[model samples]
Target: MTKQQIWEWFANHSKQILDFLLFLALVSMGAFVKILKQVRQGAKASWKWFLAEAIVSFFVALLVYGFFDQFMQTSTLFTYVVCAWCGSFSTIFHKRMEDLLGAIFDKLKQLISEKKSL
Candidate 1:
């Protein structure tokens, strides 16, 4: 294609690219909100746990990106895998937090009942 034709095509598609980026940003924000809700529901709000998750996620992301850069070198496939892994990991982590919260609640209730009967 001619230079003029390439320039015209880019001009026409720039808005679409911007819109897609905005959509991705919104999706990320939504996911973060969901994760926060799960963290809040846990038995205790521990900074240690938050820090650990952050560290793990950072290392995981770096490892994946490095591996892809070294071998696959396919941006599209790397993005897809990262998104899928992040989504699945978030879901599992949230469920585990909920379970821990439930267990804590049960124990607290039992303790209260025992105290009331004493």
Candidate 2:
């Protein structure tokens, strides 16, 4: 394709293109976290861990992206922030998300529950 054709095609699908880039970036960052941890532990860098983290990051990004698109309003910045946070730091993010969700559920359950006797 010509330069103009490529540019037009990119413009038409910019959202998909950017989202994929975000996913790859998150995967790289996530995998790199293993190196940092290993360094802290006085160990050599492990390709096995890197590959595992990258796979986890990809799946996390995919899940967040799919859910955000399906359930939330389409805001590119919000989507990017959420995907980056959760994908790059799955363990921490998962714990935090669990707490946040628990708080929300607790509030909802409290609000919907009937009053108890004294």
Winning candidate number (lDDT): 2
Q: RMSD to the native, candidate 2? A: 7.9
Error of 1 at 7 (Å): 29
Alpha-carbon lDDT of model 1: 0.60
Worst 10 residues of 2 by lDDT: 109-118
lDDT of 2 by residue, 1-118 (tens): 9999999999999988987787677556654664576568776556776666667766786788778877886676677667766676775656788999999999987877745422
lDDT of each: 0.60, 0.71
**Tens digit of per-residue lDDT, candidate 1, span 1-118:** 9999999998999977774565355435434554576677773456876555545444444455466656777665445456435542565655787999999999999999999999
lDDT of 2 at 31: 47
Worst 10 residues of 1 by lDDT: 22-31
Candidate 2 clashes between residue pairs 3 or more apart in a chain or in different chains: none
